[model samples]
Target: MIAVSDNLPAGARQPTESGDCIDENDARQAANWVAETLERLSRSSFRSSFTLSPHDAEYARRKGRELIDRHAHEMLAQRVGAAQPAKDGRQTPWRGHPVFTAQHATACCCRGCIEKWHHIPRGRELSAQEINQLAGLIMAWIDRDLAAHPAVTGERDGWAAPPENPKDAGAEQGGATPQPRRRSDAAGHLERSRRHPDNHHADGASGFIQGELL
Candidate 1:
């Protein structure tokens, strides 16, 4: 299970605050890496133009969240100094998800970069809490990048479009639908109000007008 505290084993460095796992400085560095990587890739004639589709972006987010849930221990082992061998005893193959790509780009993928870029030096195993926080930072960076550059076809600039009338969402589900009042009803209400302001108050004609407009 992933721990959510900064508590660490003795001889390990105290973890940074969870909220500061991915700060403005980290985000800035990720952005620069993203820009430079793409620009460099563009120069390669053999490099195909590849951008993550909406499906790919969604997959990356889902996988990232799932990784944090199911693979925290393994991730920590690989990231920190567990010295665990791979299944084939060589090296674990990198998962080609965009979040992984972003993790590499953002220097959040391993302890070496985490130490160099994030200032989290490696001497002892990372606490589960730290691993979880690192996962969150990588996921956040992936989400931020995806939001900034959306897939061309599915959404507008990585944001889902708002419904025409957001307030009317409830109206679809057994809510009282407001019926438009006829012109005659409006005219009659006006006449009643004009004929007697005191009478209008007494008969609640003003109230009727308010209800009708709504």
Candidate 2:
């Protein structure tokens, strides 16, 4: 987990009450490791044709770092009404702080890895069972890491719950009930969520009229 700091950039989003650049990096590493670590997960957990190249990994990492530097700390500042995250010249990551730390400290955040875990970005390209299997692999990876990591195991206050599996939308998480939105999401939103499009993963073109992603 990253320490909270006085480092910040101009025109950044406000920081949250609490911050964790360290945690963000951990999640990034974990996500990447998870993708590579458990290559034997069920076929449904991974697409036979899908694979991440070294170039792809590097590109994603760089983008993740850019995202963290540009928007993460500021968002943290606003969340807790706290001071913005100050720049520390530390290495950046794909996952940002505040929210990333707010999530599981051990859960992975490498977008490429998560893509393997859920295959949501490519969901439309595959079957439902494949997606569920992919999600399960991700779930299993996080559970295993949480059981193994010191920060996750020995702490009562630092550890938080992981996100509900989309496949288990109606399932319980850690003995707690889950709630889901009643309405189906917009196609454009789904596309944005999946990080579709060529230029970037940003929601969509800014100031442009929205259209159905599919």
Candidate 3:
């Protein structure tokens, strides 16, 4: 990933209250919003033209972050007319993450399918709660911007978000999976199960926001 400091023009120091990461949370929220917006863009017949296989999703998931690293480097310059930082030291850039386009390209195929898609990068230590949180953030974002989601509203009006993987969609279509499943109880649900993938994100942008707030 690009060094947070590099994002500033030469001589830009950390904000007096908060340094280089000033816009980091804003970056995460905007990136996710952009991602949901990407999903709504999927109605193109070209979508069918390019269905991504899980293997490909795996490949992208494996390589995407490295790509994020490179793009982050490219994004190091000044905010392209972003809003000023918040009073509490929050930075919210208007342009969103440069990787949003790239992320969308990858997400088109991976939509609702892979649980692994939610996995933290290979070297990170993530908890289940974190992964769910990120997933929630991703979904919550979609809820807010349903109208803003291009795939859903633009030329691809019929385009619905796809399952993250082909197999999952296939199971649903073919009825291979059981139609009915047990309703999960809240509170104890997470407690009884093994760790969830999103716990990482709870540690991720989602968690950072809640945890730091708490």
The digit string of per-residue lDDT tens for model 2 on 84-181 reads 22221111122222223211121122222234333434212323332223333434443343334322112222232333235434322122233332
Q: What lDDT would each prediction earn against the true structure? A: 0.42, 0.30, 0.29
lDDT digits (tens) for residues 84-144 of candidate 3:
2122112211112323222222221121211223333333322333332343333333333
Count clashing pairs, candidate 2: 21
Model 2 regions lying over 4 Å from their true place: 1-93, 96-124, 151-214
Query: What lDDT tens digits, residue by residue, belong to model 1 across residues 1-214?
Result: 8857665444444323342345455556655755564454344221212233343354434334444323433444464434322221112212334544444434444454455445666555666555655555555555555667653433333343222344433432112244333232433532342243232123223323333310
RMSD of 3: 19.3
Off by over 4 Å in 1: 1-55, 61-95, 151-214
Candidate with best TM-score: 1
Candidate 1 backbone clash number: 0
**Candidate 2, RMSD to the unseen true structure:** 20.4
**Lowest-scoring 10 consecutive residues by lDDT in candidate 1?**
85-94
